[model samples]
Target: MKSGDMFEAEPGSANRQEINPLLKLALELGPLMIFFFANARGERIAAAFPFLQDLGGPLFLATAAFMVATAIALAVSWVMTRKLPIMPLVSGAVVLVFGGLTLWLQDETFIKVKPTIVNGLFAAILLGGLLFGRSLLAYVFDSAFRLTAEGWKKLTLAWGVFFVFLAILNEIIWRNFSTDFWVAFKVWGIMPITFIFTLAMVPIITRHNLGDDSPQDP
Candidate 1:
């Protein structure tokens, strides 16, 4: 029922080093915060820097900073663990690609749609893994709790569907709203929604936990 036992059961997890929960969260959220900040203060930032004035506008400036921050986060993770976390790595790749296009073409549309692409990709990956009988969510949550096989399947299914919903929500918001509103929502709205959804899963996790005191169905 321990984390070690869960890792041993998962392929390629035996040697995985557990990242500190707070550090992991900071690494993930840090780049996002920078993105939001850069967007909100893009004009002021560009005025101060003078050199960044050529980047066009707030969204483009945010995209540039986001790409840089994501690379730094990945590099820090690699240096500390000698292995890149799968989900972050995938998201970082998308950021670099779409961010690059946004900058190169001077089009904010690419950057605006980046979340839809990333979320849709995650949803596809999770759902596809389920089709192949793999509960890949275990990779992300293994350090948090140990769950029964059925528990993992259910949790993974829930997350996969949630990702799909996020992708759609992102498309709706970005397409119908102003750029500033979208930037604020991406930072303020999405993270809180995800945090609430994670909290809501406590009952499911408690029911299927492999702890000694957890109840089992008859």
Candidate 2:
């Protein structure tokens, strides 16, 4: 399975047109990283700046900065590609909307539960796509693997289920854990769990390999 076809890359700049996965991850995760570090250094920063003490706490400062950083990232991506990624666009829009509510209402719960809403929406999109005889997950994984139709169907189902699982996990984390723990898990836990889940699909991927001997490239 060639990894090239999944990306709807522009001609002549196929390499540059599509953002690299790792860099994309960084952009998506950068704000959260800033939040975690800001929370960790809030006291020091407050001591140095003095005025930051009015922001209430390190956590508050972190959330404010996260909002700014996320907005910046989306802006940069929009500028570079002139196209918004489906998942990030959805998530970023939710962030802006809910982040605005959180700031406006001065209640952090809105931001805390944003993941739950996002995951639930993704699960619905994938599951509903299947119901409509469409596998929207293809748009995401297509960039990474050129699997056969059967592989795509199976993989899409797997992703749909995985998203449901993530929603449940997020619900549990936020419900049972402290705000700090939830924030930490949001940043550190999701990527590793997703990477592991992606690796776990290797067997199905192998079964639908679509090898060099099977089909000649046009």
Candidate 3:
């Protein structure tokens, strides 16, 4: 249940190192806040630092900052824990690729659809893991909490389906809305929705809890 056990404690182990929950939350959300801020003020930023103009428009500049922020977040996580968290690693990879394409092509669409791609990939991975009897969510959630095999399976299924729904929702939002609106939604809307969804899972977690109760990494 303690933050210190986040990375160090295994299900059966007692020893743990201090890892601040606030720091962990900051690392996860910092890059996203950077992205939102950059996009909101991208024009002024480009004007102040003309070199950023080379990256293209506001969206392109924002994409560049996002890529850098994601890299820094990942690096900090590695330095702190000596191992990359699986979900963030995967999300960061998608950010770099899609961010690269957005900058390179001077197109905002790539950046907009990055969420769709990432969520869709997660959906596929979780579902595929089920087909293979792997329960891969265990790898991501294991250090945070322990669950029965049935609990893991049900949780994985729920998350996989939720991811698919998010993917579809993202596609709908981006394809039908303005760039600014989409940016706002990505930063303000999606994050809160995901948080609420995670909170909603507490009862499910409690139903199949296995006693370990370290905080989950989002």
Cα lDDT of model 3 by residue, 41-100, tens digit: 999999999988888877888889999999999888877876566677889999999999
What lDDT tens digits, residue by residue, belong to model 2 across residues 1-218?
Answer: 25543333432233434567787778888987898898788889889988878765777767677788988887777666655566676777777787777766777788888888888888888788788877676666554555676776788789989999999999999889998888788778998999899999999878876664453111
Query: Considering every candidate listed, which one attains the maximal TM-score?
Result: 1
Please list the residue runs of candidate 3 whose C-alpha ends up more than 4 Å from where it truly belongs after superposition.
1-19, 213-218
**TM-score, ranked from best to worst:** 1, 3, 2
Residue 82 shift from truth in candidate 1, angstroms: 0.3
Which digits, one per residue and each the tens of the lDDT, describe model 1 over residues 33-122?
999999999999999999998988988999999999999999888777767788888899999999999999998999989999999999
- Alpha-carbon deviation at 94 in model 2, angstroms: 1.0
Most lDDT-accurate candidate: 1
TM-score of 3: 0.85
Worst 10 residues of 3 by lDDT: 9-18
Q: What's the TM-score of each model vs. the native?
A: 0.91, 0.81, 0.85
Candidate 2 root-mean-square deviation in Å: 5.5
lDDT of each: 0.87, 0.75, 0.82
